[model samples]
Target: MKIALIGYGKMGQAIEAIALQRGHEVVLKVSIDNLEDNTIENIRKADVAIEFTGPESAYENILRCIEAGVPVVSGSTGWLDKYEAAKASCTAHNSAMLYASNFSVGVNIFFALNQKLAALMQPHPEYDVKMLEIHHTQKKDAPSGTAITLAEQILEQNKQKTKWVNHDGSNASDLVILSERIDPAPGTHVITYTSAIDDIEIRHTAHNRQGFATGAVLAAEFLQNKKGIFSMSDVLGI
Candidate 1:
């Protein structure tokens, strides 16, 4: 497959290496310095485009790709607040787009485990649920996107908590999501259900960015000739 890389940073470079290893050609690499490379002609030239940019640029980047009549797979986070807008634009333009909070296969499994555990714990009010996520110091978001997804899943099962708290402490009715930024850490997410009797914890630790890169490549491969917005679950068959 011919691929175009949008945002040639660490993740972009990693994805490029894996795509080449898989015998895929990278036709275009658009970085911050070269915004013109993201134009319609450049984006439409590839079979698919993979985006790994910041939250602020994610929505706009996807919009541009859609306008270019190119399918896209984006792993960017924190711009989900505008997900409706992106979805609407994709439908309006009849483009294919896949977005995921964390593209790691392990993380996707953890997401399933999180939902199952939340359902199991919903009937038992004794257990208090909390989430902790740690990432590299350079990560921009406070609580990682994976953490937010887990928190949302838990809330869907347990209606008692309406929102998530991103700090060490929380109010009486809040589900807490703690964020820790440590140097050189790939990614670590732990969800705990605590009770007077015992504690149940589920964690997914990313050894490196390779898993994410590989997943992005897989998404790009799956995105060819596809339409509408999709997710990692669709890519992994989860």
Candidate 2:
């Protein structure tokens, strides 16, 4: 498989290394310095494009790939407001797109576990749920997307949480998601169900980017020749 890296940051480089290790080739690499080279023609050279760009550029980058007849797998977050538009574009072009807030296989599994736990705790409404996610200081978006996904899963199952707030919710129906930025921390997400009696917590700590990188490559492999929108669940069949 030929992969085009839409963001050449730490995650992008990590994906490239993993893709290569899996016998895939990195054909095109686009970074902030090389924005001009992100043209559709250049992006179309690869079998699939793996985008890990920021909110400001992720939407446009994915559109460029779709327009150029390239299948795209994006792990970018914070720009979900435009996700529907991207999906519509993919369908119109008869192309393929796969997106995941965090592509780590462990993280995706953690997502399922979180939902299951939330359902189990629904009958026992005494437990107040809260989340904390810590990432490297360089991470731009607060309340990391993985944290948001976790919070969303909890809100769906736990009736007590109607919404999620970054720090504190206005009332009990809000799920609090606390975010911390500390250097050298790749990522750490913790979901705790706290009550007067005891605390039950589930945590996923990333020692490095390899898990995410590997999962992205695996998604790319699964995305070949596929059309329409997909998620990590589709690739991993979770």
Candidate 3:
């Protein structure tokens, strides 16, 4: 399949390597250096588009893919407030789009585990839950998108948590999501449930970008000819 990489940063380059290894071609590579090439006419050349830009450009990039009638797999974060709008545009244009916070298969499975554990811990209000996520210093979004996804899953299952806070939460109903930026760290997330008796923790760590890149390519492959919105759960069938 022909793929267009909407963000040619480290993640985009990694995706390109994985796509090529999987017998796919990357037709377009858009980055800060070449914003002029990210046009509807240029986007239409690819069967699918993989978007890994920052939140500032994710919405517009996703919309352009829809307008071009090309399927899109977006792994951007910090712009989910406009997700509904993007889905509406896809529906109106009959375009296909897949979005995921963390495309690593392991992370998705950890997501599933997180939900189950949250459900199991719902009745035990004594155990207060908090999260810690560490990423590379260059990552723009604090608390990371994967951390948000995990927090959301916990919120859905645990009624005690009504919202998530980026730091040590002051409110009892808030889920604390502490973030740290360290060099050489791709990603790391830990969900901890603490009580007077014991502590329970589940974590997911990434050694490199290959796992996420592979999943993005897989998602692009799945969305090549389909329509409507989808998540990583759809691609991994989890």
Q: Return the top candidate by lDDT.
A: 3
Whole-model Cα lDDT of every candidate shown, in order: 0.91, 0.93, 0.95
| lDDT for model 3 | 0.95
Q: Cα RMSD (Å) between model 2 and the true structure?
A: 0.9
lDDT of 3 by residue, 1-238 (tens): 9999999999999999999999999899999999999999999999999999998999999999999999999999999999999999999999999999999999999999999999999999999999999999999998899999999999998888889999885899999999999999999999999999999999999999999999999999999899999999998889
Model 1, 1-238: lDDT tens digits are 9998999999999999999999999999999899877888888889999989999899998999999989989989889999999899999999999988988888999899999999999998888888899999999998888899999999999867778999766475799998999979999999988889999999899999999999999999999999888989998898
lDDT, residue 16, candidate 1: 99
Give per-residue lDDT, candidate 3, residue 164: 95
Which window of 10 residues has the lowest lDDT sum in candidate 2?
161-170
Tens digit per residue, CA lDDT, model 2, 1-238 = 8999999999999999999888999999999989999999999899999999999999999999999999999999999999999999999999999999999999999999998998899999999989999999999998899999998888888887788999865688889999999989999999999999999999999999999999999999999888989999999899
Model 3 scores a TM of: 0.99
Q: Report the number of clashing residue pairs per model.
A: 0, 0, 0
The full ranking of all candidates by lDDT, starting with the best, is 3, 2, 1
